[model samples]
Target: MNFDRKYLVWALGYLVAGMCVGLYMAASKNHAQRVAHAHILLVGFAVSFIYGIIHRLWLDRPGKVLATTQFVLHQAAAIVMCVGLLLLYGGVLSEPVLAPVLGAASLGVLLAALLMIWLVRQSGRAEAAA
Candidate 1:
Protein backbone atom coordinates (compact mmCIF):
# COMPACT_ATOMS: atom_id res chain seq x y z
CA MET A 1 0.00 0.00 0.00
CA ASN A 2 1.01 3.59 -0.56
CA PHE A 3 2.32 5.77 2.21
CA ASP A 4 -0.72 8.02 2.11
CA ARG A 5 -3.13 5.11 2.48
CA LYS A 6 -1.13 3.66 5.35
CA TYR A 7 -1.17 6.99 7.09
CA LEU A 8 -4.91 7.30 6.60
CA VAL A 9 -5.41 3.98 8.32
CA TRP A 10 -3.13 5.00 11.14
CA ALA A 11 -5.02 8.26 11.56
CA LEU A 12 -8.35 6.48 11.73
CA GLY A 13 -7.06 4.04 14.30
CA TYR A 14 -5.80 6.87 16.45
CA LEU A 15 -9.15 8.60 16.19
CA VAL A 16 -10.93 5.53 17.37
CA ALA A 17 -8.54 5.07 20.26
CA GLY A 18 -8.92 8.72 21.17
CA MET A 19 -12.69 8.35 21.24
CA CYS A 20 -12.42 5.36 23.51
CA VAL A 21 -10.16 7.23 25.86
CA GLY A 22 -12.58 10.10 25.91
CA LEU A 23 -15.39 7.78 26.84
CA TYR A 24 -13.36 6.25 29.63
CA MET A 25 -12.45 9.66 30.98
CA ALA A 26 -16.08 10.65 30.95
CA ALA A 27 -16.96 7.63 32.97
CA SER A 28 -14.31 8.37 35.57
CA LYS A 29 -14.46 11.29 37.99
CA ASN A 30 -10.83 11.35 39.05
CA HIS A 31 -8.94 14.40 37.90
CA ALA A 32 -5.64 12.60 37.30
CA GLN A 33 -7.28 9.86 35.37
CA ARG A 34 -9.12 12.35 33.21
CA VAL A 35 -5.96 14.28 32.51
CA ALA A 36 -4.07 11.14 31.65
CA HIS A 37 -6.77 10.14 29.22
CA ALA A 38 -6.78 13.57 27.65
CA HIS A 39 -3.03 13.56 27.19
CA ILE A 40 -3.02 10.14 25.58
CA LEU A 41 -5.89 10.93 23.27
CA LEU A 42 -4.91 14.43 22.29
CA VAL A 43 -1.14 14.46 22.30
CA GLY A 44 -0.13 10.85 21.96
CA PHE A 45 -2.57 9.60 19.38
CA ALA A 46 -4.30 12.52 17.67
CA VAL A 47 -1.42 14.89 17.10
CA SER A 48 1.16 12.28 16.18
CA PHE A 49 -1.14 10.44 13.82
CA ILE A 50 -2.21 13.62 12.07
CA TYR A 51 1.35 14.75 11.65
CA GLY A 52 2.42 11.40 10.31
CA ILE A 53 -0.33 11.41 7.71
CA ILE A 54 0.49 14.95 6.67
CA HIS A 55 4.16 14.13 6.33
CA ARG A 56 3.50 10.99 4.34
CA LEU A 57 1.26 12.90 1.99
CA TRP A 58 3.36 16.02 1.58
CA LEU A 59 7.09 15.49 2.20
CA ASP A 60 9.25 15.34 -0.91
CA ARG A 61 12.92 14.52 -1.29
CA PRO A 62 14.91 17.39 -2.67
CA GLY A 63 17.96 15.60 -1.35
CA LYS A 64 18.29 12.38 0.60
CA VAL A 65 20.03 14.13 3.48
CA LEU A 66 17.40 16.84 3.87
CA ALA A 67 14.56 14.34 3.69
CA THR A 68 16.16 12.14 6.30
CA THR A 69 16.79 15.14 8.52
CA GLN A 70 13.20 16.26 8.30
CA PHE A 71 11.89 12.79 9.05
CA VAL A 72 14.12 12.49 12.12
CA LEU A 73 13.08 15.90 13.38
CA HIS A 74 9.43 15.15 12.91
CA GLN A 75 9.55 11.76 14.58
CA ALA A 76 11.68 13.02 17.43
CA ALA A 77 9.34 15.88 18.12
CA ALA A 78 6.33 13.60 18.17
CA ILE A 79 7.98 11.13 20.53
CA VAL A 80 9.26 13.78 22.90
CA MET A 81 5.98 15.60 22.95
CA CYS A 82 4.01 12.47 23.65
CA VAL A 83 6.37 11.44 26.42
CA GLY A 84 6.32 14.92 27.91
CA LEU A 85 2.57 14.95 27.95
CA LEU A 86 2.41 11.59 29.60
CA LEU A 87 4.89 12.67 32.24
CA LEU A 88 3.07 15.90 32.86
CA TYR A 89 -0.26 14.22 33.22
CA GLY A 90 1.19 11.59 35.47
CA GLY A 91 2.66 14.32 37.68
CA VAL A 92 6.17 13.18 36.96
CA LEU A 93 7.15 16.27 34.97
CA SER A 94 7.01 19.88 35.99
CA GLU A 95 5.31 22.48 33.81
CA PRO A 96 8.55 24.41 33.37
CA VAL A 97 10.18 21.42 31.75
CA LEU A 98 7.14 20.09 29.87
CA ALA A 99 6.23 23.37 28.26
CA PRO A 100 9.35 23.62 26.12
CA VAL A 101 9.10 20.07 24.89
CA LEU A 102 5.46 20.48 23.97
CA GLY A 103 6.24 23.78 22.32
CA ALA A 104 8.93 22.19 20.20
CA ALA A 105 6.55 19.50 19.09
CA SER A 106 3.94 22.09 18.22
CA LEU A 107 6.49 23.89 16.12
CA GLY A 108 7.47 20.69 14.41
CA VAL A 109 3.87 19.91 13.54
CA LEU A 110 3.36 23.45 12.28
CA LEU A 111 6.42 23.14 10.07
CA ALA A 112 5.09 19.90 8.63
CA ALA A 113 1.76 21.54 7.92
CA LEU A 114 3.54 24.38 6.19
CA LEU A 115 5.47 21.89 4.14
CA MET A 116 2.20 20.28 3.08
CA ILE A 117 0.82 23.62 2.03
CA TRP A 118 3.94 24.35 0.05
CA LEU A 119 3.81 20.98 -1.64
CA VAL A 120 0.21 21.54 -2.69
CA ARG A 121 1.07 24.95 -4.03
CA GLN A 122 4.01 23.56 -5.94
CA SER A 123 1.83 20.89 -7.52
CA GLY A 124 -0.68 23.51 -8.55
CA ARG A 125 2.06 25.66 -10.02
CA ALA A 126 3.51 22.74 -11.93
CA GLU A 127 0.12 21.84 -13.34
CA ALA A 128 -0.46 25.45 -14.34
CA ALA A 129 2.91 25.65 -16.01
CA ALA A 130 2.14 22.53 -17.98
Candidate 2:
Protein backbone atom coordinates (compact mmCIF):
# COMPACT_ATOMS: atom_id res chain seq x y z
CA MET A 1 0.00 0.00 0.00
CA ASN A 2 1.07 3.58 0.63
CA PHE A 3 3.56 4.93 3.14
CA ASP A 4 1.25 5.49 6.09
CA ARG A 5 -0.77 2.36 5.50
CA LYS A 6 2.31 0.19 5.83
CA TYR A 7 2.88 1.34 9.38
CA LEU A 8 -0.81 1.02 10.17
CA VAL A 9 -0.82 -2.55 8.98
CA TRP A 10 2.12 -3.34 11.21
CA ALA A 11 0.30 -1.73 14.11
CA LEU A 12 -2.83 -3.74 13.45
CA GLY A 13 -0.82 -6.93 13.23
CA TYR A 14 0.78 -6.18 16.54
CA LEU A 15 -2.62 -5.49 18.09
CA VAL A 16 -3.91 -8.83 16.91
CA ALA A 17 -0.84 -10.64 18.21
CA GLY A 18 -1.10 -8.82 21.51
CA MET A 19 -4.72 -9.85 21.87
CA CYS A 20 -3.77 -13.46 21.23
CA VAL A 21 -1.02 -13.26 23.82
CA GLY A 22 -3.43 -11.76 26.33
CA LEU A 23 -5.94 -14.49 25.70
CA TYR A 24 -3.31 -17.17 26.05
CA MET A 25 -2.19 -15.73 29.34
CA ALA A 26 -5.72 -15.65 30.60
CA ALA A 27 -6.41 -19.21 29.52
CA SER A 28 -3.14 -20.71 30.71
CA LYS A 29 -2.91 -18.52 33.83
CA ASN A 30 0.75 -17.88 33.10
CA HIS A 31 1.80 -14.24 33.42
CA ALA A 32 5.24 -14.66 31.94
CA GLN A 33 4.23 -13.02 28.69
CA ARG A 34 3.05 -9.92 30.48
CA VAL A 35 6.02 -7.86 29.35
CA ALA A 36 5.72 -9.14 25.79
CA HIS A 37 2.04 -8.36 25.78
CA ALA A 38 2.67 -4.84 27.02
CA HIS A 39 5.40 -4.13 24.51
CA ILE A 40 3.40 -5.45 21.57
CA LEU A 41 0.34 -3.48 22.52
CA LEU A 42 2.03 -0.23 23.50
CA VAL A 43 5.24 0.06 21.55
CA GLY A 44 4.21 -1.94 18.53
CA PHE A 45 0.55 -1.00 18.20
CA ALA A 46 0.30 2.43 19.77
CA VAL A 47 3.63 3.93 18.73
CA SER A 48 3.44 2.60 15.19
CA PHE A 49 -0.08 3.92 14.81
CA ILE A 50 1.12 7.28 15.96
CA TYR A 51 3.85 7.21 13.36
CA GLY A 52 1.30 6.33 10.72
CA ILE A 53 -0.81 9.27 11.77
CA ILE A 54 2.17 11.55 11.53
CA HIS A 55 2.93 10.28 8.06
CA ARG A 56 -0.64 10.80 6.94
CA LEU A 57 -0.91 14.30 8.35
CA TRP A 58 2.38 15.39 6.88
CA LEU A 59 2.18 13.73 3.52
CA ASP A 60 3.12 16.80 1.53
CA ARG A 61 6.31 17.69 3.29
CA PRO A 62 9.61 17.87 1.42
CA GLY A 63 12.88 16.24 2.41
CA LYS A 64 11.98 12.72 1.56
CA VAL A 65 15.36 11.59 2.83
CA LEU A 66 14.51 12.48 6.42
CA ALA A 67 11.00 11.12 6.13
CA THR A 68 12.20 7.86 4.65
CA THR A 69 14.89 7.50 7.29
CA GLN A 70 12.39 8.15 10.05
CA PHE A 71 9.95 5.63 8.65
CA VAL A 72 12.61 2.95 8.29
CA LEU A 73 13.96 3.62 11.75
CA HIS A 74 10.51 3.50 13.29
CA GLN A 75 9.58 0.21 11.64
CA ALA A 76 12.94 -1.34 12.39
CA ALA A 77 12.83 -0.16 15.97
CA ALA A 78 9.33 -1.54 16.50
CA ILE A 79 10.25 -4.92 15.06
CA VAL A 80 13.58 -5.16 16.83
CA MET A 81 12.19 -3.96 20.14
CA CYS A 82 9.26 -6.33 19.98
CA VAL A 83 11.43 -9.31 19.07
CA GLY A 84 14.10 -8.43 21.60
CA LEU A 85 11.58 -7.95 24.36
CA LEU A 86 9.86 -11.16 23.41
CA LEU A 87 13.14 -13.07 23.58
CA LEU A 88 14.05 -11.49 26.88
CA TYR A 89 10.65 -12.12 28.40
CA GLY A 90 10.70 -15.70 27.15
CA GLY A 91 14.18 -16.22 28.59
CA VAL A 92 15.59 -17.16 25.24
CA LEU A 93 18.29 -14.52 24.94
CA SER A 94 21.51 -14.80 26.88
CA GLU A 95 22.82 -12.14 29.24
CA PRO A 96 25.37 -10.56 26.94
CA VAL A 97 23.29 -10.20 23.78
CA LEU A 98 20.09 -9.28 25.61
CA ALA A 99 21.25 -5.94 26.91
CA PRO A 100 22.85 -4.86 23.67
CA VAL A 101 19.85 -5.76 21.52
CA LEU A 102 17.41 -4.08 23.84
CA GLY A 103 19.61 -1.03 24.15
CA ALA A 104 20.01 -0.64 20.41
CA ALA A 105 16.31 -1.11 19.83
CA SER A 106 15.51 1.47 22.45
CA LEU A 107 17.95 3.89 20.89
CA GLY A 108 16.46 3.30 17.46
CA VAL A 109 13.00 4.04 18.78
CA LEU A 110 14.21 7.17 20.53
CA LEU A 111 15.93 8.44 17.43
CA ALA A 112 12.89 7.81 15.27
CA ALA A 113 10.68 9.63 17.77
CA LEU A 114 13.06 12.56 17.88
CA LEU A 115 13.16 12.66 14.11
CA MET A 116 9.40 12.75 13.91
CA ILE A 117 9.28 15.59 16.38
CA TRP A 118 11.83 17.47 14.36
CA LEU A 119 9.86 16.96 11.17
CA VAL A 120 6.65 18.15 12.77
CA ARG A 121 8.30 21.19 14.26
CA GLN A 122 9.94 22.00 10.96
CA SER A 123 6.64 21.76 9.18
CA GLY A 124 5.05 24.03 11.73
CA ARG A 125 7.79 26.60 11.21
CA ALA A 126 7.42 26.41 7.46
CA GLU A 127 3.70 26.88 7.67
CA ALA A 128 4.13 29.84 9.98
CA ALA A 129 6.66 31.40 7.65
CA ALA A 130 4.29 30.91 4.73
lDDT of prediction 1? 0.59
Per-candidate TM-score against the hidden true structure: 0.62, 0.89
**lDDT for position 120 in model 1:** 54
Model 1 regions lying over 4 Å from their true place? 31-76
Worst 10-residue lDDT window, candidate 1: 59-68
Clashes of each: 0, 0
**Under the 3 Å rule for N, CA and C atoms, how many clashes does model 2 have?**
0
- Model 1 Cα displacement at 56 (Å)? 11
Best by TM-score: 2
Q: RMSD of each candidate?
A: 4.3, 1.7
